[model samples]
Target: MNSSATPVAVDMGSSSVRVTAGSFDGARLTLSEVARFPNEARTVAGRLVWPLHELVERTRAVLSAVADEGMSSVAVDSWGVDHVLVDASGHAVAHPASYRDARTRGIPDELARRGLTAQGLWSRTGIQPDPINTSHQLVATLRQLAPAERDDVARVLMVPDYVAHRLGAEPGWSRAICSTSGLAEPGGGRWADDLLRELAIPTEWFGDIAPERQVAGHFAGSSDVPVIRAGSHDTACAVHALPSAPGPRVFLSSGSWSLLGVETDRPLLDDAVRAAGFSNEVRTEGGIRLLRNLTGLWILQECVRQWTREGVPTTWAGLTRDAVNAPGATALLDPDDPVFQTPGDMPARVRDAVRRNGGRVPESPGEVARVVLDSLAVSYAGTVRQLANLTGANPSCVVAVGGGTRNDLLNQLTADACGLPVAAGAAEATSVGSLLAQLETLGEIGPNDRSAIVDASFDVRLYEPRASALAGLAPPNLERLS
Candidate 1:
C-alpha cells in the first residue's frame, strides 16, 4: 500500500448511499464525504423494486472519481436480507425486490402452514422470523417467478455483495452480511442445507461464505486499488468501529431501525432468547451480536413526512424544541406496531394505536413526537434489562451510535430509562468501521490500534442518567408490546 493512499468506504443505506474517503495520519483517521445520492425503492409494474442500474451507475462514477484522487482500497456495506439474482453471465435477472414489498406479506404464515414452525426454523438458523428475511423473500420471489425465469437465476447475492461483484470482485458472499439472511447457519458458517431443502430453494444459488478484511479483487478500472471485504453488513460495520472497551458492551445502532444488542462469543439460542424477540447475527471480528431489532426513528420520520405533505413542513430543530416544551406524554406507544410499518397517514395511525391502548390520543405533532421518543426510550431500557437477564453480563454503559445519536433528548431519555450513562458518537460509524478494516487489511494499522484512532478521530458526547425522569415510568413489557 502507498503511504499516501486513501481508502474509501461505501455505505449503502436504505435511504441513501454515501461514499466516504479516509486519510490516516499514522495515529488518527480523517474522513470526508466524496459523494452522496438518494437511494429509494420505487414501484415498478405494481411491485416495489430497487433501482439497481441507477445505483450501480452512480456508485461507479463516484468510485472512478475517487480513483483519480489516489484511492487505495475500498469496501461496501449495506442493509441485509434483500438480494440480487444474476444469470450465468453475471447479468441481473431482474430488479431486486424491496424488503418492504407486499409479496412477503403472508410468506411466514405460509411456511408455517407447510409444517415449518417458527421455533423449528429458529433452532436451525438462530434468527428471528420476519417476513422481510431473505428466506421469506426468496419464497415469495420463486412463487411469483415463471419456471423459466427462475431457471435463469444462477446466483443470489446480498445487496452489498452484488454491488462489489459489479465492481470486479469475484462473486462471493461476505460472512457478516450472509448472517443477516435467515437462510444461513448461525455465525454464517454455511447455508442451512436442511432448511433450504425444506424451503425448496435451489442450493446452487449460494456460494462459499467469504470472511471479512480480505481482498476480493481489484477495482474494475484501477488495478492498484483493491476491493476488500470490510464487513458487508451495515450494522456489523458500525459495531466494528466502536471504541474497544473491557467490560460488557451494549450498543444501539440507532437509525431508521434501532438494533440494540451486546456481543457474545457464540449465538444464544435458548427459547427464552427467541421469545424475547432477539436475533443473533455474526460480527465482523468473529462472534455473535445478540440483538433485538426494534422500530426506532421510522415512526418519527413517518410523522414528519406526513406533516410535510400536509403543507406544514417541520424542521428537526424546531420539532425537537417543541417536543421538549410540550406537556409530558399521557400515552405511550409500541413503536413496532404493524400499522406504523408502511407509508401513509402515520400521525393518524399513531393516534389510533394510543386510543386502542386505552390512552389519551395525542392531537398535536409535538405531542405525538414526544410519545414516540418516550416510548422508544422505554423500549431501549427494557431491552437492556432483557440483555442482562439473557446474557448475565452487566452492561457498563450504553453506547449509542449512528444517526439517532444526534438526538440529545432521546439520548438523555435512554440514559434515564436504563439507569446508565450514554456515550454517543460515531454518527458515521459504518464508514468508520469500514475504513478501519480497509486500513488493517492494507497493513497501515493493526487491530489493537483501532481504539486509539477512534478516540483521536471523533467527539463522544456523554449523557448522565437523570434518576428523576424514571419516577413513574417502567420499562414497558417488550414481549407484550410486540
Candidate 2:
C-alpha cells in the first residue's frame, strides 16, 4: 500500500460490477481492483428484474473489501437507458427494465405517426435515437400497464443514481451516462424537455444531473468518498481505455456488439448516417461518440455456446485460432441486420443473412466462424472510412480495443481493409477506462494526464495495412479476406 491516499471508482455493467481504487500520480495512475460481481438481468413472472437489492449488497461488500484494503473514496457508473423508478418514499418503486427486451419496437413508429422525427431527436439529444431508449420503453410501459400503476410512479433515476440513493447519498447523477439513454440531450447536459413532451413521456420523471467534468456527489463508504461521474456511460469508460493515438483514430470495442466509430466534437445527424444505422453516444468530455452499433462477436459467442451445448468443446480462444487458420471468407453480412440482434438460432440467421445478400453460407463451424470474423473486419474498415469522412480526420491507424482485439485474424483483416495500422490488444481497456475516469473525477488526473498514464501501463501492438486492400476500397467490393 502506497502510504498515499486513494479514491475508488465503481463501474457497474449489465454483466458485472467492478471497484477500482487509485489516485493519479500526474504521469500515470496507480490502480488496484477490490471486487467484482456476476450480474445479469433475469425474467420472473414475465418482468425483467435487475436485482437492485442484491447489487447493493454486493456494492457494500465490495466497498467493505476496499476499506479493508485501505482505499480512500468510491464512485459508481452503469450501462445506460435502464433506470430505477423511485416512489415518493424514495424507495425503488419498480425493477428497472433491460434494453434487450422486445417492447420498445413500435413506440418510435407510433410517435412518428404523431409527427416526431428521429432526426429532430438526434439534434436534441445529440444521441442516436434507438427504440430501446428509455423514453420509448416508458411509452411502451404506458401502453401495456394500467394507468393507476403508471400514475403511482414518482421519480426515475438511472442505475448509478439508484445505487447512490441506497448509499444514503444525495444522488448526483451523471448526464454523460444519461446521454446514451436515447432520451437525454447529446450536446447539452440538460434533459431535452421538448423531446420528452413530444414523446408524451412525463417531463418530471427526470431530475437535474451534472456533466462528467463536475464531481457529482460524495459517497461515505468507510471514508468520505467523492463519487465522481466518471463518464457514467459504459462505452465512454471503455473508450477511455483506448490509447491516445497521435492522429485521428477509430476504436472498435468489439464484444456482444461492435461499437464502431470515432469521437467528434459535434453530433452527426445527417440523414445518411442515421439511415446507415449511425447514432451519437456521448463521450466523457461532452463529445459525440459518432458510432454505428453492429452485431459483433455475439454471433460468434452464441455459435460457440450452441456448439458447446452440442458437446463440440468449442471456446473463444479455440474458435479464434481455428478462424485464423480457416481457408477464406465466402460472404459477409451487414453487421446491423436485425436478424442477428436477439438470442435465437444465430447460425441459421448468419447463413440466411449471407444467402439473402448473395453471399455463400458456411458449411462447418470453422467456416461460420471465419464468416463472422471476416465480416467484422470488413465492417470495421467501412466504418473507419466513414468516420474519417464524417470527422474529416484521416485516421492513419485503426485502434482495435476490448476483448476481441486478441483475435489476430480480425486485427490483421482490419489493418488490410482500412489500409491503416491496426493497434490491437490491451484486453482490459474497459476496466482501465472505468478506473481512470474515477481517478480523473477525484481531482487526481487531468485530460493530459490520461494519455500519459495509458501509454505507460498498456502494452499496445500495431499492424500495418496492406496496399492491396486499399485498392479494393472503392465504391464496390474489393474486400480482403481475414
Candidate 3:
C-alpha cells in the first residue's frame, strides 16, 4: 500500500490521544484512523497530573505508525489550560498538576490580595478570573516550590507544546489554548507581561501565543512529515466544525464538559457576562470565545459508571430515553454544585440532591439516567439564554458538537428547553476541527471555507424547537408557551 496520497491529524485530549489520516482530493478529505493510545490523569503526591511522559510516548507511537503507513502532513491539538514546565534542557520540571486538584483553592483570593482583582485582571488581560485557570495553578505551584527553582525554569509549554517539544521540535504556545488559561489578553494573541506581573505569574511560565495554522515545523524525527500548530486547543478545534456562517451562531461542545458560547469579534466582559458565568476566550483567528464552564456529562457518566459497578447496566441512551418518558422537572439541581466538582458517589449525591430538592430519590437506573440527561439539557437551555443576555447575541440556532451530540434525548431536550433549533452532528467535531486546521495548514483549504467543507463532509442533525416543550424551565404552574 503506497501511503503517499493521504494526510493525517493528531488530537490530544484529557483522556486519550487519537490520530486520523485522510485524503484531500481538492474538494473534501476522507480520513482513516491511524492510532489511539491510553491517555488519562493520575493523582501524584495528592495532586491530579496528566501522565506527561507517557502521553508523549503514546502520541509519538501512534503518529509514528501513521508515519510508517505514509502521510503528507500532520497537525497536533489538545485540551488547553494545563502545561508542563520544562527546564532549559526541555525536560518537565515537575508533573503538571491536574486543574481539578484541590491545591488550586484560594489562589484566586491570593491573586486578589496581590491586587489582581477580577476587574483589574480583566481590564488588564480580558481573561475571566477563575481558580481552575493555569495562572492560578502556576501561582499555587510556585507557592509550593522554593523561590530558587522558579526563576531557573526555561519553558512553560502547555501540554500540547510539551508533547511537540519531545517530538523533536520547538513547541508553540497556541492562541486557541492559551486564551483558556486566563492569562492571555483575551481577544489579543500575545501574552501580557503586565497581567502576569499583577497576577504574580513568572514570565517563564508561558510562551508567545501564536495562531498555529500559520507556522510550520518539521516533526522531530521525520522531516518529510512536518507538523502545524493547528489551533492547538481542543475546544477551538471543536468550534471550528460548528455550523457558523453568515449569522449569529453558538457552538455548544458538550462532552465530559459543556462549552456553550458564541464566536464574537470582540470580548464581552461586562457586568452581565461576569454575573452569568460567561468567559471570553480567544479563538483560532483571534476571535472572542464567550462561553461558560458547565459541568456536563460528568454527572451522567459518573452515575452510569456507579450503577454499572453496582450491577445495574445504565447506558446513556437507556437513561435519556427514560428521562424523556419520565415526568419533566420533578427535580432541579445546582449542576455546578461543588459536590459535583470532583468524582465519587455521584448516584448517591444525585439521590440526595433530589431528596433535598423536595423530590423523591431516583430508585432505578432509568430514573437516575433520566434525571441526569434532563438536567444537562435544562442547564444548556439556561446557559444559552444567559449567554445571549450577556452578549446580547441571541443566536438563532445552537450547534451541538462532540460525543454528547450523539445523545438524541439531550439534543431534543436542548431544543425543547431553549426553544431553538439544534444542529448536531460530527460527533468527531473536535478531531474534525483539528483536521480542518490541518487541511488549512497543508494549504489544501482556507479557514473561511468551513461552511461548504463541513456541509460536504458531515451530516448535520437539526432539531427544531417547539414552543410547547419549553414549559420545563418555568415555575411549573404553566404549560410551555411557544
Best by lDDT: 1
Clashes of each: 0, 4, 2
User: Of the candidates shown, which would achieve the greatest TM-score relative to the real structure?
Assistant: 1
What clash pairs does model 2 have?
8-73, 125-185, 125-186, 126-186
True-vs-predicted CA distance for residue 427, candidate 3, Å: 0.7
Write model 2 residue lDDT over 293-313, tens digit each, in one string: 766777887787677777888
In model 1, residue pairs whose N, Cα or C atoms come closer than 3 Å (at least 3 residues apart or on different chains), thus clashing, are none
When sorted by lDDT, best at the front, the candidate numbers are 1, 3, 2
TM-score for predicted model 1 compared with the true structure: 0.96
The local distance difference test score of model 3 is: 0.74
1 or 3: which has the higher TM-score? Answer: 1
Candidate 2 — what's its lDDT?
A: 0.71
